[model samples]
Target: MSTEAEYVRIDDGVLEITLSTAAKGTSLDFAGVAAGTAALAELGADIGAVLLTGAGPNFCAGGDIRDFAAAQDRSAHLYQLADTLHIFVRALDSAPVPVVAAVHGWAAGAGMSLVCAADIAVGGPGTRLRPAYPGVGLSPDGGMSWTLPRLVGAAKAREILLTDAVLDAAEAQRLGILARLTENDEAVLDNARALARTLARGPRASYTSIRALLSRSATATLGEQLDAERDAIGAAAGSPTGREGVDAFLAKRAPDYSGLN
Candidate 1:
């Protein structure tokens, strides 16, 4: 699976998505979007977790500004580009397994959007995030407008994007953008990979249920959320994965979830 993938690799039940371009920087160009979409689509139920990272200093620098600048019809080109990028972004959002990101250096524009969509983001001292769209005379894409407010609240998301605020590692962690912080910038990716592997060894169905319930809670009334949770928990408790987890707990042994998910 890894050999056929242009920007993704699957190993030890974890899919690592390397968002890197030939220039050694992460950019949401046509190739990157297409590669990411295909990689995510092909994973199916083969993996238990997805890890997102970059190949260079920055996680993602944003869109391919050079391509956008060179386009004859900038409006039409940008519209199509953004629309396609959204498909990849939505795949990350709706992935059955957990999505983790190793956010280092700069996560600007679309990069920041990806960080927002991640279930868990690991960063380091040098990590910085910015909503760079306004600087390019554009609005948010990749569901940034929707995910940011959920992470940092509506007012803060508004201020951050409108003012183009740059969030350093500490600030981003405090604001819940980053779920974990490593010792330094270089440790971010390694730590995130370890976390993804750890999650891959757990109950995949439970994780999916948790992700779905939390996402639904964003707009669900208290009663609605309670009902949803009840249904999810009931289903999980009756699943094969759930039975193995319980048996392992009672026997004080490690659960083998390898074939369960």
Candidate 2:
């Protein structure tokens, strides 16, 4: 892989995906997006969690505006760009393990979308977010329209997107956008990595089921969700990990999940 593509690596059952490029901003161009897509596609059963971070002054300033400006056929160009980005976003969403993000500096445009997509986000005191699409005279993409509403509710999402409001770390945390807030930029990644490692040691299959159940609860009726939960709990109880957990509790010892996953 090229230097630009060396953005993913697995360590101790955690897949760490760094979003970076040689470009001016931390925003992903075609190369970075493609690398991310490939990395997520190659996730294996041994991988128990994912940690997403950005390199440079910002988490991600959004898509490549310079590339957008350089496009001869702007409409077609943006269409392809958004389509490719959605593929990576979908992979991130569907990954069986929990996903965490270390967000520092300005997370604008697509970067904001990513913060919304992460299952958990750790932000620093300097973290800020903006729906940069409106400022660029475009609508939201990369599932921002879908994910933002789920994170902050429809009315708040509408207001923020329509106004292109900038969200500071405290406000973002209050809105449930950032799960944790660090004292400084350096601590953001450390805390997120620690959280990812903790999650990596958990029951991976149970986490997958929990993710699916919560995602489905958004669109499913109460009755439908209840039924789904019933099935999931039943399956979990019958699994080896579940048995180990119960045995460990009864024996007053810690469960050994390392051998299972």
Candidate 3:
């Protein structure tokens, strides 16, 4: 059997997902969702965070143009491709744990969308991002249109999508597209993994609730946001882990989250 497009391995509390075919620009294939979805399904509730990174120099160069030409009917093939890709996007969005992206090289097209969807992203000095869609006479997909505007505002998102502008890591950081830059020479994957490890020891339920709150905030009205926060916090307060967190704080000790050492 051919190797899967991605590989997932959990060590400690971090689920590390690496794009195995970096030479192919980490372009996600039609079947890529199966491996990724299966991996997320295997993550027990106790797991802390999911870390995503490409295997080689470039992050993901987007879909394969050659493959696009190979498809006998481009319209139907693209629809099928997007359908599979949406599953991966939904998995990331609905995952109880936070997703940390380590972006390097070129995060083009859908690859850039993956970065935008991340809860936190760490990039390096050499990292570069481009919206490679317009160049091919295609439009954005993989939730890029939705998430990019939220990060960089509507006008800037339009610029990035419409023009063939390339955003360097520093520029991406300034625009709030990248959370922050690793050291000039630091390995982005290592930095992201370290961050995820720290998060892995945090209170799981609270983190999950935090993601849910953030997700809803994108579309919720002010009153709705407040209500969601109220209900979520209330539920968390009644959880065993939440009670232990409170007790630990009052007792003047570290909060020993459910699986924390």
Candidate 4:
């Protein structure tokens, strides 16, 4: 709704969410975080997947230092900003529809956190992800600490967080921070969109169930995870999409998943 972010319902159930700040640095202030949160919350029932990207040169440069300095009550100002960003990050995790981040140039601080929150990330050749918090005499926020450790292991995540390590596209990909890489920014977004479209057409219940299991894996014990997986798989098997897939296989025909939710 604001220039901070643009929300578009691209046909075929894909929601294209792009950071829209025109600033050269492209850092998000409090308003931008709130705007993004609102945009994500507005995803309708018709929407089946989301593709997140950036406008112009860089993806995002993290918090706008200028905005922070200009605030009269810096502490309260930051509290509000972080709170809003936290909500957006939580929404990304709980979203029924899967999300993909199409990242290029820079994804710093909260920007990098957003990428980490996505179900998948596609990075462009020029992508460089880093955390700007340590450089600013602050610590990581927006779930960066939690996401990165799970992503690249605790030792590497500690090095990244404490040392302001910059992860180039290749390194990020190798570390599993990026799901795929493209030759350029356009290709990055294009690939992400294609992935989103495919996900949109997939069995909704199965996709959501898989996401739910993964979300709980970190805290769940082996037995707990096994139980969760068993339940999820059983539910999926009973779903219309699952039945249709079985019937299609038996008939030697393409499954009509269009009948699924």
User: Could you say which candidate leads in lDDT?
Assistant: 2
**Model 2 lDDT tens row, 121-231:** 999999999998889999999899999999999999999999999999999999999999998887898899999999999988889999999889999999999999999
lDDT of each: 0.87, 0.88, 0.83, 0.82
Look at candidate 4 and tell me the lDDT of residue 232: 81
Clash pairs, model 4 backbone: none
Per-residue lDDT for 1-261 in model 3, tens only?
Answer: 545534667788888776435556567544445677778877786578998777666777788888988999999989988877888889999999989988877788888988998999899999999988999999998899999999999999998898968999989999998997988635787888899998898887888889989888988999999999999889888888889999998999998885532
Q: For this target, which candidate reaches the highest TM-score against the unseen true structure?
A: 2
Root-mean-square deviation of every model? 2.1, 1.4, 2.0, 2.0
**lDDT for predicted candidate 2 compared with the true structure:** 0.88
**Could you tell me how far off, in angstroms, the CA of residue 162 lies in candidate 1 after the best superposition?**
0.8
Q: Model 2: C-alpha RMSD to truth?
A: 1.4
Relative to the unseen true structure, what is the C-alpha lDDT of residue 23 in candidate 2, on a scale of 0 to 100?
54
Show pairs that collide, candidate 2.
Answer: none
Worst 10 residues of 4 by lDDT: 1-10
How much does candidate 4 score in TM-score? 0.93
Q: Local error of candidate 3 at 98, Å?
A: 0.1
